[model samples]
Target: MAKRPQQSLHRPNDPAMLLLTSLASGPKHGYALLKDVEEFAGVTLSPGTLYGAITRLEELGLIEPLESVERRRPYRITTSGLTALREVTREMGRLAKISATRLRLSGEFA
Candidate 1:
């Protein structure tokens, strides 16, 4: 089957993109995704929130479950998910740069 395309922009600050981006590296289950996000981005997510995001992403065709040996299902990033990750990362970088410039000008953290 053909892979879905990446997204150009995230759905308005939705945190799911971060989860999808991390999964782009490989397949991971819901709990794994949560731990990875916390380790990589320092973002702690509740189980309910993570499941909700996963469900939404699955519905959107950005991600899907991969076959697994464990009870928990594993998920991988689809083509569309990769695109979304790229877009989200680019936008996040832009926002960070802008924040840094503003901070520097204000001598807040110089």
Candidate 2:
């Protein structure tokens, strides 16, 4: 048997993906975001981790907070953030097609 060369692939684990993708649908507060992400991605980000990413995204103009009625604040993706998400998803889509093709050729997929 011959060993197949491994191809480097862009994974969807980038820290901002969760928040950005979630906000792509609509705005959400921290707790709502945490629940939504967990429900959708099955990953639980600690408060510190989530806040850290939130702060960085805000600094980069990728996300902004919405006016809130109470303590919890909601956030929406900025135009720049949507652009970034589109690019990332496009790349992921290309990789997915490539992976599917490779798997089919290798007889690993039906």
Candidate 3:
């Protein structure tokens, strides 16, 4: 039997994805997004990293800046971002199901 390549557990270069996902619920300022993402992912993001993610997501049409006269501009997820989030969530669900089945089988054998 051929061995399958090892899968990466970490999401590579996914800060933008994470930011978009967070924004899907509603609009949020930069600082708010950073705080929420840190709480959700358990990772402290530097300003550079957070800003870069926001810029990239904006460029990709995944998010857009909301109406604001303040320096702290809030952003909202676009329809495209919602669609992408839905697809990613579906994939995550599939992976979780597969892992659950494997773990249950292993526990039974043990």
Best by lDDT, which number? 2
What's the residue-level lDDT of 18 in candidate 3?
Answer: 71
Evaluation by lDDT, superior candidate among 1 and 2: 2
| Model 2 residue 13 CA deviation in Å | 2.4
**Candidate 3 clashing pairs, residues 3+ apart or interchain:** none
Error of 2 at 47 (Å): 0.5
Top candidate, metric TM-score: 2
Native-to-model Cα distance after best TM-score fit, residue 31 in candidate 3, in Å: 0.3
Give stretches of model 3 more than 4 Å off.
1-13, 105-110
- How high is each candidate's TM-score? 0.75, 0.82, 0.78
Weakest 10 consecutive residues of candidate 1 by summed lDDT: 3-12
Per residue, candidate 3 scores C-alpha lDDT tens digits across 1-110 of 53211111124236876787678778999889888888887767789989987886777677889877578789998887777677766667677678778778545433
Displacement of residue 92 (Cα, Å) in model 2 is 0.8
Off by over 4 Å in 1: 1-14, 105-110
Ranking by TM-score: 2, 3, 1
Q: RMSD per prediction, one decimal?
A: 5.1, 8.5, 7.5
How far residue 108's Cα lies from its native spot in candidate 2, in Å, is 12
Candidate 3 has what TM-score? 0.78
